[model samples]
Target: MASIEKLPMLAAGYEKLTAELRALRDERPLIVDAIEEARAHGDLSENAEYHSAKERQGQVEAAIADLEDRVSRAQIIDPTTLSGDKIIFGATVTLLDDDDKPVRYQIVGPYEADAKAGKISYNSPLGRALIGKRVGDEMEVSVPAGERFYAVEKIEFI
Candidate 1:
C-alpha cells in the first residue's frame, strides 16, 4: 500500500480550505439547476447555455475534488505551540538582506503562502534555506530576480 503524504498547514489555512469546500458544495445544487434550465432550451448540439453550464460544472467538480484531497491530507499546526531556536515550519523569521534591510516572513504551507503578506511557503527557495537555521546564520537563494543572500536575525513562534 502506498503511504499517504500529509500536508502541513496552519489551523487558519485548514479552516479556509474547509470553508471553500463548503461553498463549492453549496454551489452544486445551483449548478444542477442551471444545467436543467439550460437543457430545457432544447437542441443540446448547439445550445450555448447548456455547453457553458456543463463546462462550469466540470470546473467546479474538479476544484471540489482538489480541495477535498488537500483538506483530507491536511495536518494542522499551531505556531504558538512551537518553541525552538532553529527555524522550522510556522516560524516567523526575520532576515537581514545583503543591504542590511530587515525582511520578515512566516513559513507557512503552500496554500497559505502570500509573499506580499510576508507569508512564504515552506517549500519556497528562501524558506527551504532558512529551515534549521539559527540567528546570525547566513544563506543564499536563487530567485527570479537573481541570487540573493540573507542572514537570520531573529526567529519567533508567533
Candidate 2:
C-alpha cells in the first residue's frame, strides 16, 4: 500500500480532531444498543429500523476509519512555538486588499480550513499566494472570480 502523506496542522486543530475521535469511540456502546434493539424488532426483510441501524453503523465505521487515517498521518505543529516574521503555514496573516481594507487569515491544513473563521487551507489559492510573503509585500492571488491583489500588512504566529 502507498504511504499516506502527513497532514500539517496547528496543535489546536490536532487536539480538536483527537477529542472528536474519542467522543465517537465513546458512542460505540450506544450504537451497539441501537443495532440490538433494531434486530429484536424482527422481520429483517421489512424492518426499516434494522436497515437504518445498519446504515448508522456503516457511517460510524467510516467515520472511525477516516479519523484513524488522519490521526495516523498527522504532523502537528504548534504555532506558539514558531517564531517568524514572514508568512508561512500556521501563521496568521493580515492583508490589505485593493480597496485598502484589512483582513486577517490563518494559514491552516485542509481539515482545519474554515473560511468563515478566517482560516484558509495551505493548498488554497490565497494561502499559496501568501506563502513566503513578508509584511508590506504585495501579491496577486487567483481566485474563482479572477485575480485579486493583496498587500501583506502583518504576520503573526498566533
Best by lDDT: 1
Misplaced by over 4 Å in model 1 are none
Give the per-residue lDDT of model 1 (tens digit) for 1-158: 99999999999999999999999999999999999999999999999989999999999999999999999999999999999899999999999998999999999999999999999999999989999999999988998899999999999999
Candidate 1: worst-modelled 10 consecutive residues by lDDT: 122-131
All predictions: root-mean-square deviation over Cα? 0.6, 1.6
- For residues 1-158, could you state the per-residue lDDT of candidate 2 as single tens digits? 99779999888889999998998898888888988998898888899888888888888889989998999899998777787777888999889998999999999999999999999999999998889999989988889989899999999986
State each candidate's clash count: 0, 0
Worst 10 residues of 2 by lDDT: 78-87
Give per-residue lDDT, candidate 1, residue 1.
100
Task: Indicate the TM-score of model 2.
Answer: 0.92
Residue-level error in angstroms, candidate 1, position 57: 0.5
